[model samples]
Target: MDLPDPQFSEFVTAFLKDRGLPVEDLQFHSLPSDGSKRLFWRLSPQSDTSFVAMENTPTDDFSKRENVAYLMIGRHLFQKDLPVPEIHHFDLANGWFILDDFGDASLQESALPKERRISLYESAIEILFRIQTEGVEGFNTEWCCQTERYDQYVMQRYEANYFRDAFLHKYLGLKKDWPELENPFNHLAATASRADNQFFLHRDFQSRNIMVSAGKIGILDWQGGRLGPLAYDLASLLIDPYTGLSSSERDEIYQHYLRFLNKYDPRQVEPFRKYFPYLAVQRNLQILGAFSFLSKMRGKTFFEDYISPALKSLRHLLEDLKDPQLSPLKEAVHS
Candidate 1:
C-alpha cells in the first residue's frame, strides 16, 4: 500500500524518533477500510511497540468536524476512565493521529455458526454500562460531530428517512410513497424517544468497533458519541446482523444486560425494556439504510454483504413487535 503525505511521514518520524525508534527500521502496513472515510495504517518496528496512525485528508465540512470530535470525545472518555483507545498524539487541523494498536481481536471475531461469541459480548456489556452511566459526567454535546442527542427528529430524518430513501427507494429501486410510511415511522420515533436520553451513547456501538486489546475491552470510532437513550446502544449490539446471533442468544445476552443494569440502576430496567424493541427496529432500519447508502452511493461494497442479513433481522423484529401502527412499515419491508 501507498504511504501517506510527507507531512504525515515527518510527524511519524518525529513521533517514533522521540520514543527511540529509528526512522530506517519502521514498516508500514495498510489496514482494511471500514465504513469510515479515514485511512489507517499500522506502523511497526523491530521493537515491541507498534502504533496505528490515522490519516484523514478532509475535503468536506463534516469530516473536519469529525476529526475534532474524535480528538475531544476521545480525551473526554479517557479522562472519565472509560475503555477507549489511548490517543497518544493528534493534529486535527492536518488530520493525523498516533494511537495505541489494539490488535485485531474484535468482539465479532469469527463466532461459530450455531451460537455467536457470548463471552466477548458479555464483557463488552460491562464496558458499555460504564460508557452510559459514568461517561455522561461532564460530557459536552459540542464534542459531538453530528446531532447531540438521539431524539425523534434524529429518528425521522436520519434513521427512518435513511431507510426509505437510501435502502428502499434508491438501492432497491422501489417506488415508495413515503407519505404512507409516515404513520409507522412516527410511531417508532415517538415510542423510542420516550426512553431516557441523558446517558452517554456510542451511536455505533456494534461488534466491529468493540476491540479486545490485552484481554480488556476497548472502544473505537467514538466520534459519533453523544447523549442518547440507554437502550439504544444495547439495541445496536443485540440486533447486529454481522454477528449472526440467534434469537435465543440475543435474549440471553439481553437478559444479562438487564441484570447488570439492575445492579446499578434498578429504576431504569423496566423503562429500558419498554423502549428496547423500538430502538432495535430503529437501529436495524439505520443499518439497512447505512449499508445500502455506503455500498450504492459510496462504492464501499463490503457493506453490501451485510444488507441481506440486516434486512432479514429488521423484518423479524418488525414481526415480533406487531404494533398496529407499524403496518405501513411492515408493508414497506415486505415490498
Candidate 2:
C-alpha cells in the first residue's frame, strides 16, 4: 500500500469515518497501471474492508464529467436492481473519494476462446438494455447536446497545419487537401444533429471499463455518462480498440443488441444499424486524430501502438461507405 498523495489518504480516512464505515488503520493499495488519469487504492479495516481512491482532474476534462455522470446513472441503476459498485463516500470539495473494490476481475483477465466473446459482450449489453428500457433520470438531452459540438473544433484543429503540415506532410511525406476532409465531417455532423435518439450513454463503455466478478458484469469508468445517441456506446463497445473482436463476433454482438432493442424499442433497428456504421467511421477518425495529437503534442507517445489499428479500422469502415466525398478521403488515407 502506497499513498502518492498523503493528503488524499488522510481525507479518505476522515471521509470514511463520517460515512460510518469502520475505519482504524486504512492501508492504501497501489494499482500502478491507471491510464489517462491517476488512481490509487486504500483499504480500511472497515466493514467492507476495501475502497478504491481516484483523483479528479479539472472540470473541463471529460473525465470529471464522466465521474458525475457515473454517480447519476449508478444511482438510477442501483435503484432498478442492477449490478453496480456502491459509492462508499465522495468528496466534492477536493475531488477525491473512496469506492467499493469490485474485485480484481477484468474482461482482460478472463480470456476465453474467441467464440465466447459474443456471449460475454451480450451479457454486458443486457446492462445497457436495462438502463435504456427502464427510464433513468438525471441523464437528459443536455448530456448529448454537446456530443458532436466538438466535431467542428476538432476538425478545424486537425485541418490546420497542426496535423497535415506538421506530421502527415513533413514526416510521412503525405500531402492532400485539408479542406476536403471536412466535407464528410460536415455531412456527419449534419446527420448527427438530425438523428437524435437520446439515451444514457456510457461513452467509454467497453471491456476495459467493465469488470467481471461474482458471476456479474460491473461497469466502471463511467464518469462521462451523458445523454447521447445510443449509437455512441454501441460503437464504443463493438469497435473497441482494445479486446478487438473478430468481424463475426462483432456481428454476433450487433445482432444481440438489435434483438434487445427490438424487444424494448423496435423502431430503433433501421436507424441503429444505418447510423451505427457511420458513427463507427466518424468515431474511428476522431480516435485516430486524438491518439495522433496526444502523441505529437501532449508527449503521450505511448499511444503509438494504437494509431495503426485505429487507422486500419478507419480504412475498413470508410471503404464500406458509398458516399463519394468519403471515398476520396479514404483513398487519401490508405494511399
Candidate 3:
C-alpha cells in the first residue's frame, strides 16, 4: 500500500485531535488523481465520519497560483453557503488541507434513469445558477488564481491557441496547418468576447467535478472559478462529452435552465442565447486542447477516449450554426 506522508498524516491526526474527534487506528488511502497537480487522500478512522485531505504541491508557477486560489476561493464559497466541502485545516506553505469527504461517486458515475438523471441535472443547474449570481458578491478579483476575468486574451491563449498547439499540431500531427486557423480563431475569440462576463464562472463545471452525495449535489474543482460569461459554464455542462447527453436531452435540460435564467432577468436570456454557441465552441476547443495534453503528454490516458466525441460535437455544432467566422475552426476539426 502507498502510505501517506508521515507529516501530512500527522497533520490530519493532530487537527482532528484538537477538534475532539478520535484518530485511533487512523489510515490514509490515496485516491486517483486528475489532470491537475493536486493530490487527494481519504482519511479513515475508527468510528468518526471520514474526511478528505488535499495536497497542492506546486510544480510550476501556475500550480503555485492554483494552491492560493483553492484556499481563497474555497473559503469564499463555503462562506456563501455554496455546496463546496467544508475546509477543516490548511497549511498553505506546506500545501495540504483536510476537508469534509463527499465520497467517490461523481455525477459522471450517477446511475439514475433518464428522467431521474434530468431531475438531478435540474438540481445541478439550480446550484450553478446560485453560484453564478450569489458568488459575485464579496468576490475579489485579487483572489482569482488564473486570469481574473474571462476575456479575449484568455480565449485566444488558453482556448484557441491551446487547441491549435496541443490538440492539432501536437496530438493530430497538423503542425503546418495551424497558420490557417489564425484569422478564424481571432474572429471566434472576438465574437465570444461579446458575452457578458461579470457573472461568476466555474471554468470546468462538468460532470466529473460534480459530486452527487446521497442524492444532493456537491461541487468540487472550484479553484478555477472566475468572473466570466454566464453562457460559458452552462455551455460546458450541457456539452460535456463524458455524460454524452443526447441532443434532445440537452435541449430539455437547456429549457429548464432558460426558465431559471428568465426568472433572473428576462432581457439577459436573449443576449445569453445569442452568445452561447460561440462560448460553447470556445469551451469545446479548450476541452480538446486540455484532453489531448493530459492524455498524450501527461500520460493520463483517461481523457483520450473523449476527444473523438468532443470533436464530433464541435463539428455538429458548427454545421448547425453555419457561421462564417468559425468555418476555419470547423475545417481544422474536420481534418
Choose the strongest candidate by TM-score. 3
- How far does residue 168 in candidate 3 sit from its true spot (Å)? 0.8
Error of model 1, residue 259, in angstroms:
0.8
Model 2, backbone clash pairs (residues 3+ apart or across chains), number: 4
**Candidate 3 wrongly placed segments (more than 4 Å):** none
Off by over 4 Å in 1: 110-116
Ranking by TM-score: 3, 1, 2
Cα lDDT of model 2 by residue, 1-335, tens digit? 54557777677768777777766656677774435555666575665466777666446656555556555556666666766777766765556656777777776554356655666777888887766555345445343322523233533353323444544554355665566766766775556534444566565676677888765788776555555567767777777676767788878888888888888778888887777776676566556665666676667777667778766777778777776767656766787
Pairs clashing in candidate 1? none
Error of 2 at 204 (Å): 1.3
The deviation in Å at residue 59 for candidate 1 is 2.3
Off by over 4 Å in 2: 16-25, 32-35, 42-48, 57-70, 135-177, 296-302
lDDT of 1: 0.88
lDDT per residue (tens digit) for residues 121-238 in model 1? 7788889988988889999999888889999998999999999999999999998668988888998999999999999999999989988866588899999999999999999998
lDDT of 3 by residue, 255-285 (tens): 9999999999999999999999889999999
How many backbone collisions does model 1 have? 0
The Cα RMSD in angstroms, rounded to one decimal, for candidate 3 relative to the true structure is 1.3
Residue 164, candidate 3: how far off, in angstroms?
0.7
